[model samples]
Target: MATSAATPHNKIIGQRELVVIVALLMSLNALAIDAMLPALGQMAAELNVQDGNRRQLVVAVYLLANGLGCLLPGSLADRFGRRPVLFVSLAAYAACSLLIAAIHSFEVLLALRGIQGVLCAGLMVVPTAIIRDQYEGDKMARLMSLVSAVFITVPVIAPSLGQGVLLFAGWRWIFILFAVVAAVTGLWVWLRLPETLHPENRQRVELPVVLRNMRTGLLNRGAIGYVLGAGLLVGAVFGYVNSAQQLLGEHFGVGEWFPLVFGGTAAMMAVSNIVNSRIVERFGARRVSHAGVLTFIVVSAAQVWAAHYRPGELAVFLPLMATNLMLLGFLGANFGSIAMQPFARIAGAASSVQTFCRMFGAAVVGLLIGQAYDGSARPFAHALLMCSVSALVLVLFSEKGRLFRRLNPPRQQQPAGPPPV
Candidate 1:
């Protein structure tokens, strides 16, 4: 568990290769979700979905499955080793993508998409455990921010990519692309990526032990508080993502330009993440996260006010929404890294727990916001404002009401104590 010892274990991949692989693996989740944004209407029309609200299910179901299914990968990775678990999950993900393309039934597509989402959970959990395997505290935050900066490119390009594919090809071709990407990535990983989970660190595959570790992670105030807090904060992003196509196309009448608007917002997030990777090392995760959340709250509040007065205007709405998302990039990576600080010894299960909490919580928030679509941006903006305030409260409570304080420094052995209740 020494940072000194972890250095060598992590060095095999080298920094640049490690970043690239981790970014791609992590982006699988984003790519799968975002790439289908432009085609949601087309998909629904082709599939004969008359209710507009139900169309968002194409996005929501995947997230729901992702949250529920993430429960397995961490425990399995801790037991089996990262490489094998990853390969299996990636193969399943690829298979699902391939299979979904040929299936025409909407109900069946959702079911298969759920299965694919579950498979994608492995893509989500293992890389974090591997990163936790290498770094801790602020350094881990920095690395995660960088990974996110790289990973955000998927969101930036995926909708546009989806739009591009839809130009000459049917929507089902999107899944074909997913199949191709997953297969190629699976091969690349199998051939190039070595197992990062060390033999000495492997845990016995036992349900009771997994539950106990998850309980411990939940009971730890810093971990659980941030888990809930960051999860709620992340819910704002998911809410926007789920409703983005409609909010742009229906409310703002951007229609075919929805991908461009969405991509531009995502690009801002990428820039902020790049900046976050640089500044988090110096400011510490706590200070940066605290400031970031406050910024998120202010932006959310302003968005609500702006949407109230300029509700129908595209010019005003897009910039504020983009700014809010850009600021969110600073919060997500650091919050997760901070939450994982207490779980070095059990990063697999801990990562699973965190992913579950974040994704499920986000799913609930997103579903509500998406369902509340009233042909205006107010519902989304109001949801953002509410989630931002809720997140700030949970984060404040997690820190025992002390903002901008770092309780654990990078590479330091964590002191044992009960967290603030």
Candidate 2:
């Protein structure tokens, strides 16, 4: 198939609308996860869940399914086009969210949440591919950072939103809100989003063809390491989220202040991403992220000490943890853009595979961290340090022991070649 020309409608989408639309699409995933945090205890108790750690399954199960679900949409989007695929997903996602709200059985609820996760996977994969269709290199990093800056606000406010809903109605209303948001966003995309995948790039959605594209993406030296490293680091964030309610609410006895405390760290992340969007084009993604990770490791080490030495002190723990999360704002967008740099031709499949690795891996690590809760922040802090050090190691391996060296300008849709055995 030869490449198709973009429609005149594509030109009508100004950059500001594009950024907001993309950010809202991505924020759907964040909102679904974060908004449920305040309601976890009530949901668990009502559903007859006895174990505290198991309450996290409300989240962990969704995350695991979300990651696994990412495997299909990209390849399908590559074949069918981004617009149709996304529309189907958004519709199903809204329906699924409503179904989860109306269900009473725990088993049925988990199954519904799993179904919703799979539907929402397209939310994660398609918008990312849409962004890649428009930008690359440091410019791509800058755009992603801006998207992230906007998207980060959902996590910052979602818990508080959930808490407010809990005060007025049952936890089920939270899912009702999710459905409303999905419907509204879906309408916006239907009205505004043009198909981004070129006709020439459309490939057969055959099993073998999809596997081959994914295999090629995973084999790229320039991308694979960052994919893996980013997954490891992102695991730390997931861990914090999984443990946050227990850590701040019960362990530290912050009680109703959990949402405020949670929002503070997320607010810092939003600021950091805003700064990164402004600076990444000038400094290069490599230099900025390398410095960010090094700083992350240092702050994480201090976090470990604080958790142990000042174990009961909320004043000491909050600021250090906030700084660590703030650093993640620098790491996520840059690492993601660099990983996607070599996959211009297969952005859909590439995005799907990389997202699967990052999300599934992070979900499992987060589940472990959540289950490890023992009324102190030491385990969480230690996990963060371990993940950061391991991430730096993988990054070094990816760069062949180099750090802060500038990546060459973007190439044509070509492979970055295979890594050494």
Candidate 3:
């Protein structure tokens, strides 16, 4: 419930407003991805895409570019401030959305999506930096969970929104809607959002300084380990998303009910975020997330067995997938907060590096898993199990062979990295 202080311009950014605005900002990315799900079949048909897996590149290429794009914005935000970086990125993202709507060639569409991903990178990294600016540890996790609760709602509805657009108009209208949403969000930030980066903490935007700051962020033992661990879990989700249309709509024969089915599973994730927000402070992030991860592994193993034995069974498939999404709800914010606990002084650079690691690694993992789809859930289920196992190993390394520990020791206890300014 901590509110941001009045800006120099006297705009009062209350906690509620901040959380809502931040969630909306993050939702732009989710909307872009999720709203495209129902339209993938149409898009591939119109574009003459012959390979089923290649259509997934629409999502995969954006994700890969988005990860690479994460590398620059943090250093820029650290130098220029969060508001400017976010505003410019939003403007450009909107433009890319419009450009995507107009492109006729599939190659041009993917290139535009790649550029849009790069622009949207700021949208992903900067709000996170803003959150890290205001809070840390479990409080940060709590607020992030709240933000996630709202942000996740996009996934719950965006497929339906896309389906609606497709019913009335062409699939391109989805991008037009994306443009409109981004423009509105960008204007709101330009006018109301304050400079959260303290004036003194701003660094010079130079290669040496940027590199040093990035190195500090990337080299931290705990942060890097958690970043990789969390990235794997997230990558597993991306793999599912990439193949969801095919698996749910075509293979499962859900057809037009696909949006509702996808949204239902996503709604479970939103519910999980709400529950995590409620309990995270009391239980501490590590214990809650650790339990979630272990539970996820067990569930993933069940998923593998079910998929191998009963690939066509929706009753078994839907609930297990929904449970995994719910488990991710517990893991994402907690892992991110733990990873970010050490970087109070260099929140922007650190956030950027951490985001880059997670997004880039997840993108690569998602691409591989998505392309491995063979008209069955086996690949997706196996990928989930592999990802969870790998994540557990990384988390153990990060905690020095421990699991389910409480809050990480404070910055002074860390072996490396700058203390809070």
Candidate 4:
């Protein structure tokens, strides 16, 4: 409820409009990956990709590139402006997507995918930085939740879109679709998005200064904890993503219907995001995130146990997987807001470092899980359980064992002297 007028330094545009645009921007990352799921096999076949495992490179490489790209453009945005960086990056992303669609060799495809990831760095970091430019505390959390709520719809629809493209036009058309969407988004961003990083508030692009700020941000106890926790949470989600199709199609025999099933579960997470948006202001981000993480831990552990006993039961598997993903919707927005809370002066750098850690962590975890794919769901379940527990421990330690303490402190306890008297 802190009005923009109170902080002249931070100009608030239309919050609702900004949230929608940022959400669309963030959805691009998910769309890039999710929309390729149904086409992975076809892409591999068409490109004569030798290694079956290497086919995942199309997705993994993109994510790794995205993480690496986060390092520089964030600083550039702080120096230049958010809108310019964002528009340029989106255009580059569109070019990469088009290149990927037209490429015949796997090498070229991999390189294009990686470049796409790198270009998306602007899309990933700038919108969050812009939100930080204008809002903080619960307001930031609320806006992020709204953004997440909007983004949740991407996963729900992307797979279906991919499948439709595959059914009609073939897999290359998937990348073409990505290119078209990126082009449209780029134009919209150029025309509609204003410069969020004001001229007066711009920081000079000093390498030493950027490094120093990054170091400081990383060293902050709360920021580090939230970053690591967010990373672990995302890593688990990525692990699930890298393995979900195989688990469903090959193991459970879901076949071409896999996309519908996947999209349905994603809709469950979307519902969780909507709920988070409603209650985040009153219940507090820390409480919601901590609760969600714990719920994730519990569900993941149960999944491990159940999978051990009945490894092939889709009934046992799918529902638990959906629930865990829903929990992530609660964790994602809150973790970012929590990490950025203590670093206001250098919000851009803080956002960058935090994003870098999350993506890097997720890439590592996803790669590890991807390697463990042995035509069973056991490895994925095990990784999820381990990650959830690790994240829970980190969150608890980060908040000084007060992870769920009320954001609004309780009234002071009366002295015990009255009882003695």
Model 1 Cα lDDT, one tens digit per residue, 1-421: 2332323245355776788898999898899999999999889989899998899998999998988888889988877777887888888888998898898889999999898988789898899998998888899999999999999999999999999999999999999999899888887786767677766566766667778777765667777778888778777788888888878888889877888888998899899999999999888988998898898888888888978898889999888888888888888999899888877767888899888988888888888888888888888888888888888898878888889886655342321232111
lDDT of 3 by residue, 49-142 (tens): 9899999999999999999899999988887788888888898889999999998999999999999998789988999999988888999999
Question: Model 3: runs farther than 4 Å from truth?
Answer: 1-8, 412-421
Note the Cα lDDT for every prediction shown. 0.84, 0.87, 0.88, 0.80
Candidate 2, which ten residues in sequence have the lowest lDDT sum? 412-421
User: Comparing 1 and 4 by lDDT, which wins?
Assistant: 1
Question: Alpha-carbon error at 57 in model 3, in Å?
Answer: 0.9
What ranges in model 4 sit over 4 Å off? Answer: 1-13, 407-421
Candidate maximizing lDDT? 3
Positional deviation of 149 in candidate 1, in angstroms? 0.5
Candidate 2 TM-score, true structure as reference: 0.96
RMSD of 1: 3.7
Looking at model 1, residue 220 earns an lDDT score of 76
Measured against the true structure, the TM-scores of the candidates, in listed sequence, are: 0.94, 0.96, 0.96, 0.92
CA RMSD, predictions in order: 3.7, 3.4, 2.2, 7.6
Candidate 2 per-residue lDDT, tens place, 228-289, comes to: 88888888888889889899999888999999999988999899999999999999999999
